[model samples]
Target: MEANDLRSYISSHKNIFVLRNKQFRDSKLVIDGCNLYHTLYFTSGLDQAQGGEYGDFETVVRNFFKNLKECRIKPYVVLDGGDGGEDGDDGEFRNLKKKGEITIRKAHALSTGRLRNVLPILVKTVFVQILRKLEVPFVQCVAKAQWETAALANEWNCPVLSNKADFYIYDMKGGLLPLWSFQWNILSLLNQSGEKFVRAKEYFVERLRPRRRRLLPVFATIASNDDIHLDKGSLPNWAKPSKGSTATKDIDALFKWLSKFKKQKQAINGVLSHITDPAYSDKVHNVLTQGLEDYQLYLSSIAEFFTSGTALPDSSPCLPEWTLQQLAKGKLDTVVMDVLAKQRTVLSFPVENSLYSSSNRTSQPIRQTIYALLLGVTDGAYVEEYDREELEITSSRVEAVLPSKVVPNLQLETLKDVKYGALGSVLSYWPLGTQHATSCHLVGLGYKRIPNNLKLSYSMVAKAKQQFFRPRQRLALKHVSHYSFSTMFRPCQKCFASDFWVLYC
Candidate 1:
């Protein structure tokens, strides 16, 4: 996720504190549905396409999942489409599967980027349909677009796990910034030792650097309530399929629907035949011909091009059915507004206990603010305002108050522990603010300083007499400010003073 999205997700969620008295519940685990499916599909397809044979798709998926299980993580998986029920027997999509002629290979081929420009809609649809058959309960978020995903995450009070930084940008209330997301995994980064893992992950985290932005409000502004224009062909590749025995049956149904325009055009042609209006007749014939060509091209690609028995139409275009007005909120929720108010406040040393607590029924503004505070602490200092007017007050301007003299020693120890690694050592050898100490630091790695410059060059020319000629190196120049090298080597050669140059040693 981009830094912006991380900040948004963190700020829009409740803070998760290390429980002082009890262990956190396991129920908080939220798995990303789309992300997981994408992982399985892409990995399997790429692996297979590269000619590395794998077992069936189910086996590949199962093995992929087995790795996650070995890590002792049980993430709750959510999906955007209807569920396919258990044993692949029946669910919301069972009837459709029974009525459709879709095969895995044909589906995969039809879903290729040559058609959709590399989009994953077809893959998502396939998984959703399969999951529904397997009885996995997933939901299409009631709100359209990313907000639906964000809203679900908010309702569940869990991290919104997704590979896309865009998810973080959408202001999902109660969305936790997901760490250890699969996107970070790479072969070289994997290590046998725990220490190496820690170092590598720290390095990786440093690089992500989510952009600082108020992303939730921005996401809320763009989400659609209804459909828009099709960047792809009609009939989204992601739509659930109706099941039937023969692929031909599915294609026949699609062809019949497409042929409707043909019938209308023919009727218009028949009516125009009796009229003397040549211009109107010509216009009607042109529209019919164009529509026919488009429909035929779509069909020909599938029915004629591949030379296979599969029956599904190659593709179609679709548009969302809703209007903008339906998707837009009339007024921002008071709770969401309150969360933003807290972001403008001052940071507390020990995050308030109120920030850590979340009830399912309660609005998650407090939690979101706390999470945002935690994220801010990691990136920089947390500055908040209790009132709008106080926002401009800098930390220096705010008066510091002394703590109570009677505060418990244990509490002090706990606070110290929490902030321990937060302020990592400025240097291994010396602390900051020490005079001469900072100057002692070398420009590069610690080493003895050398005050000379050195240069080396080589000269060569082609020789036709000898089958092969060799090039030789010569010292070109030397000057130095300060630098060091562990070791240096050169071919042995004799040096003589100008007066003794006649005598070589």
Candidate 2:
């Protein structure tokens, strides 16, 4: 659950948090890669209402890394892509399991015209490309990155750069630079080395009063909507004490009450005893205990990657070892990692026409191509893709399309060794064209020029040749900024619809 309300209340509090303004420079920064990209994309002012302007996003990412180099900040980015598992192993990715539910919720929101910040599917892919292009150090975790990132930052004795309020729970000697207050765009006044700096607010748990420190995990569990939280019906109206809706007063009242307790168990019990009904007490106790346990750090497998450059989590057996290395090194797209390993993927809601059917339907053919690249190469396989149905997320298995003719001898392990000619041949091969798929829909973007009113079947474009993928890519990058993917199409009166017309008509 999100602890937005609580983090907001804390941010407003002066004594407990105390984000001191500082000039940050000359350090190895551990960045939350997922947080950085989300902040970058949202704040960049690039087109969000359209599918996405990834070329512009590419430039934005380039500039960011370029600026960091000028400032001498060696950035080590860790992205959240893996599942943080249960049994509380090394703060792994079991925490990320809820993402499926969240994806459905977001898809639901997008379907209902309630969401405006729909991210395009390839943003993370583009981020990886730029990082590799710039030779930036990064790791795509097989599990949740929190423990790995925290461990790296602590070992380096440098601050972690992020906007995740959960950093307040971790005790850091160097501190936490809240991404919200990080003025990275502006450089500092000329220093002795002529080095640049980011003026930002730094957070240290030590700044809090002695007794209140180290209790943030407990506080977050109580405040957030994340896993291990009690049912909302059982939520103690900490606000009840004030008999008012003001969260500030309630937070103060809650803190004052919590100050007397010494141990975490006592705090958990005291709150349970006071607010929750006795019937729900046992359930509440278990939930809070489990939630608090999330913050308990173990030996992070991710940290080993930084040291020996070897530690990476296990994926499905079908995935070649080479693919896992590429994924961990940020060389391959995570989409490939997802389909082969999990046999499932959650597609993003692109900014397209709302009146027509879901825009996700239009791009279904493209994703099936990726599935083919991963699964259909050697043997036929199925992958479940999550796309929108009305306002709800619905799942259906898509069969991978094989390039049997183009790369008859090609296999997953030998993908990196695929020659240029074979690559082009494979790229031109349409992997999955359904019986009803119109060439215009796959080769072009469901229309040649602009879709005045178009919505495509999510599975229509299941597999596309590179030639087939490019025009649609252009639509997302070049045309969607001006045209909606939801626009409808019509056949030409005189001309037969062919690949050329799909590209030009």
Top lDDT model: 2
Model 1 has an lDDT value of 0.27
lDDT of each: 0.27, 0.60
Error of 2 at 340 (Å): 4.9
The list of candidate 2 runs beyond 4 A from truth reads 83-115, 190-194, 226-256, 271-287, 298-300, 313-320, 335-342, 362-382, 399-476, 479-505
Best by TM-score: 2
- Residues 114-142, candidate 2: write the lDDT tens digits: 75455655567567657877888889876
Per model, state how many residue pairs clash. Answer: 54, 19
TM-scores for every candidate against the unseen true structure: 0.26, 0.71
lDDT of 1 by residue, 1-505 (tens): 1223233333333221110111112233344566666556555553321111122334554554444344433344444321211111122233233212222223234324222112121233334434444444344321112334544455555445555444544333444344333422321223454221111110111122232121122221112101111121333232332343233233223322323333444433433454455775565455444333322211111112113423222111110112111111111111111122222222111101112211111211222222232222222333232211111212222121212221223221132233212211211212222222111122111111110111111111112102221221101000011111212112353221110101000
